[model samples]
Target: MSSATVDTPEGGFEFIVHDDHHHDDGEHHHETGTMLGFWIYLMSDCLIFGILFAIYAVVGQNYAAGPAPVDLFELDKIAWATAWLLLSSITYGFSVIKMHENNKNMMMFWLLVTGIFGAAFLYLSVEEFMHLWHIGAGPGASAFLSAFWFLVGTHGVHVACGALWLVVLLVQVQIHGLTHENKRRILCLSLFWHFLDLIWIGVFSFVYLTGVLL
Candidate 1:
């Protein structure tokens, strides 16, 4: 195939090739498809959390002679946990910015910061659960406790998985040096981390704040 040579305004000659344009379009389509698939997966996850929230809304008030939110929840601790998770989300954003700039060291450093914040959040969550359990507020204690544990525990499990994924991605960044594949993975992780942050906001507001108010 013959290629057309064109002169640019900047005095640079460009070669226009039909085959290369087609290849570029194909890659664009592939990236779009991948992101769309991930979005569908996120929507499914939202449905699961939505159902859990609905269930909790129904049974959250049923104490069955056990401790309720007012009796068990500490706003100070929950607020601190919220701060950690929120800060982790910010740090993850910084990592993405560093990734875009192709600064591997800075990206990795920000990711490490994010991971620390995530770990702190998880530790605080586990401490809350342990405190509740010790004070006779175990999951099996009542319908309310069961719902609380199921909903919050599920979110905690997601955070744990995200933290693990971050570690693997950090290794990949070290080994692969932020290739296109690695960048795509990083974008996906960014989406997942942000999604978790949004979910936690919902949990904090709807479950904790509302529970305390009622």
Candidate 2:
């Protein structure tokens, strides 16, 4: 139902109109604002990552007689982790497509696949970090290690949170079906998941590849 205000010779009155669906002005505005607010939050995240990258660029080579990237970074493992993250992004895209098609089961299935890929990426990353620590090339070893750990670890934490959020969303969708609010939440998460993929590409190229190759 929708109500509209009208003015006539009898002053002002409001009437409620019965309808199959509601399209209240306030509800539409709220949905629009949700996306706009999420975009602003993403911009803030970009700034944070930008500052981290700048810090790494400045301190990445200050090895201080410690293990360098070539000595500590195993490109084979990094490559595998990169593949997992990239695959997760692709799966997430498929999930969004299913979402738009209104196939809740397929959408949830793709989301679960994406979460698995994300977990694999995190597992590889943690194993690499453990190997580095065991070899005495941990973050405290040098300026270079510090910057590398901070930049990469921050991204890892973000991925962890995203995976957890995905799980919660799955439950919510299962309970609530594909309501408008749930759809909006899915879109917000899609942006966030894709944004993480973009940031990881920069990390792989700038931090991993550049450190090892250059």
Clashing pairs in 1: none
lDDT of candidate 1 at residue 118, scale 0 to 100: 98
Candidate 2 ranges with C-alpha deviation above 4 Å = 1-30
- Residue 66 in model 2: shift from native, Å? 0.3
Native-structure RMSD, model 2: 7.6
Task: Give the Å shift of residue 64 in candidate 2.
Answer: 0.8
- TM-score against native, each model: 0.86, 0.86
Q: Root-mean-square deviation of each candidate, in angstroms?
A: 8.2, 7.6
RMSD of 1: 8.2
Report the lDDT tens digits of candidate 2 across residue range 108-147: 9999999999999999988888888898988899999999
